[model samples]
Target: MPTPELIPADQQLSWRAITDADLDGWEALLRRMAVEDKPDWIEQRADLEEVLAAKKNNPVLDTILGVDGEGTPRSFGRISANAGSNMVHVFGGVDPAWRRRGIGTAIHEWQVARARKRQADAGIPDGFIRAYVEESNPGHRALLESSGATVVRWFTEMTRDLAEDIPEVDLDPEFEIVAFSDDISESMRLAHNEAFQDHWGSEPRDEESWRFTVTHPEFRPDWSLAVIDKSSGEVAAYEISSYDPESKELVGFIEGYTELLGVRRAWRGRRLAPALLAEAMRRFKADGMEHAGLGVDTENPSGALGLYERMGYTPTRRSMAFEKVLS
Candidate 1:
């Protein structure tokens, strides 16, 4: 595959492959972009480092950075394609101060080209490139739309105030709620895969990716919970929680994020989801968290939006996933 020029000759910025050394500059640019574009979701240094350290990510081949004349990083883009998957995920951001200079468009073009090449190299016949942007950011949305990407799905960020009355959900007597731990981590992953099997755009996470998620720096096993079927000794439901200190600092409130929540298909009608969520809320309040937050697909087949609303979570922000079919 030919390398697409990340920076146009007419542009003043220079481009290069990103490395671990660029984490500081990259994190700064991302934080600034988040503050202006999506204050509620900010990536921290550790999160950036995780991207660089991912097992399947080759920074030199999959990532690029655009720097100004003075050598200050201003924009970046990266693409990831899971093994045996037909989807290539692209993510990047441009500094607010550098908008309208064609930096974002150039980076996005490069990303799309790289995604297509990756799909072709992998021999994927029916593949697509996916990216996400906050609905409030019209410029970003326009860039994606101009690139032939359309809004494939909408996701809502919901938050519940811990000060409000927490719901008490009753669980079946045959089930028991347990704190997340190493012993049941694999079981939880299996349950998650089975739970989301029918959900749109859902993919089963391999062991490596599942490990990366459960062991993330911000993951809080003590705050996370899992429901077990006492008779069958299987994971029935789970709520994986994480605390983003950076986001807390940015918003000036302690918020516990539910990174993942699911109930196995066989356990769907048992009200295990609401019970697990309510328990998580109780734990968050006990930990002095001001809010409990999670993101849900607006059109989730399981009526997740309605369930969350009934549990006191309201929409705080909306984001759109855009996709372009790979030829």
Candidate 2:
């Protein structure tokens, strides 16, 4: 185990860079907190190997586990920045048992300091610190607001019942939807960048960062669909799906998740995306999925949230993005 760095506010409590040895204890802390805070939702296990792999891919990132004298992780935080964006993303959680103590604040303080140091090293003139909190997580929201973070954007979680028949939409004859394949990976990646480049806070993903999402343990290329421009032979849009066993096992029902859905500018208003979404839902239902879910930016210029609702998806929860400027 690595040496623990004691927090000034509480000597008994300390944090250290997490190692493979801390996986079990860290999992225990996350599971306990998830069961207590949201039993209805699945307890997603953090893959320590994958996380460590990410650190190798991006050495600037810092991941820490905070523990008490007994050596159980009471708080966790990850701080990372995107190249050229001058923005650092912060995500962390405190065990329910350790809430109301100074542990959470201390973790945030450490994250801010680490982010500043990284910015300095990179010679970034100015940067922004960003975090996301779901509406269901009131404690986190309160903490962010109290720490001078202000809401910058809102996101919605939408779900559709797979048991119901998906409406059949007549796709334009010029467009074709097909399963995602390694052959078209590069094309799809470029299309993805083109699709979201205009969106707020959008950052282009290099090959390394792009591979992390598609190669994740839960990624399901068989379920991920891509729309092709038949005439041009170019990818027009994509809906990348994944099999979330943790959520399925938690709720005792099969669920298909989509983390990314993009339609290139030229394909907008062509009914291409809606056709792909319907096809995706049908594919999920055919595979015995009970539900399909995705998160959408509420203020997306493409009118994504409205389109989702029109396609039979209902909002299950709201998540807000909070930001603080750090130079």
Candidate 3:
């Protein structure tokens, strides 16, 4: 791949690949960006570290940072493609203070170039690029739309107050809730894959992805709940959760986030989902969490949006996924 274009020589800003030594600078830059772009959001240093660590394991990932003359990161962008997949995901953000200077667009262009090079190396034809934009960010939405990107999918962040009354959802007599354990990891992964087989953009997770998810520092095993069928002793449904201390501290609200929730195909419509959701909410309430949150695809075939609404989860934010063709 050719070298990515840098800021003009006359300008004090320059572009460079992110390095391990830049973690502190990266975290600080992200915090400042969040404060300007999303005052309610919290950017955690450890989360950024975990992501960088994972990227280290991938041979085909690129992260670029736009730095000022003082060496502070003013913009960030990353392009990543899963092995054997023809689509790449690109994410980039510029410091609010640095907006209107074309930094965001430059970062995006660099990411797209890097992704195209990667697709070429992989022999992928008609490769695609995907980017996510929050509904609140008019600038990003305008930029993507004007760049010929179109919305292909939508997601909503939902939150339910644990302090409010939650209705009881009874599981079938044969199903019982249990704590997550390493022994059931394989079973859980298989169940998760099968459960989402019909969902849009669904893909079976590779071993590395599953391991990273299960062992991530923020994954709260105690908050992760699974339902088992007593008859077959098989996994029926699960809710994987994580606790965000930084978000809690910054937002002034303690919340447990359900990262993944799924039920086996045969287990659907058996009230297993509600049962699992209720259990997760109960656990969060017991742990003194003020709220529980989850993201849902608005078009989920399983009527997830309606189900979550019935469970007292209200939409807090909306995000749209956009795709652009990369020949």
Compared with the true structure, all predictions reach lDDT values of: 0.87, 0.78, 0.81
Model 3, range 124-239, lDDT digits (tens) per residue? 98899999888988999988887788999999988998888987997779999998899888888888898888888878876767887887777888888889999999999988
Q: Candidate 1 lDDT, tens digit per residue, 187-304?
A: 9999999988899988998888888788788899998899999999999999999998766766557899899999988888899999989999999899889999999999897889
Q: Whose TM-score is higher: candidate 1's or candidate 2's? A: 1
- Tens digit of lDDT per residue, candidate 2, span 1-327? 112342445536676777778778877887878876674343344355556566322422487787788888888887777665688898777888778876677677777777777788888878879998778878888888888989999988888888777888898889888998888888889998999899987788778767877887778888888988999999999988887777765655687888788999987888877887888888788888899888899999778888888888998778899998775
Model 1, residue 79: distance off in Å is: 0.4
The model with the greatest lDDT is 1
TM-score each candidate.
Answer: 0.95, 0.91, 0.92
Give each model's clash number: 0, 0, 0
Candidate 3 residues lying further than 4 Å off, grouped into runs, are 1-10, 39-43, 55-61, 249-252
Instruction: Give the number of the best model, judged by TM-score.
Output: 1
Clashing pairs in 1: none
Q: Against the true structure, what is every candidate's RMSD?
A: 1.7, 2.7, 2.2
Q: Ten-residue segment with the worst summed lDDT in candidate 1? A: 1-10
What's the distance in Å from true for residue 156, model 2?
0.7
**Candidates ranked by lDDT:** 1, 3, 2
User: Cα deviation of 143 in candidate 2 (Å)?
Assistant: 1.1
Candidate 2 lands at a TM-score of: 0.91
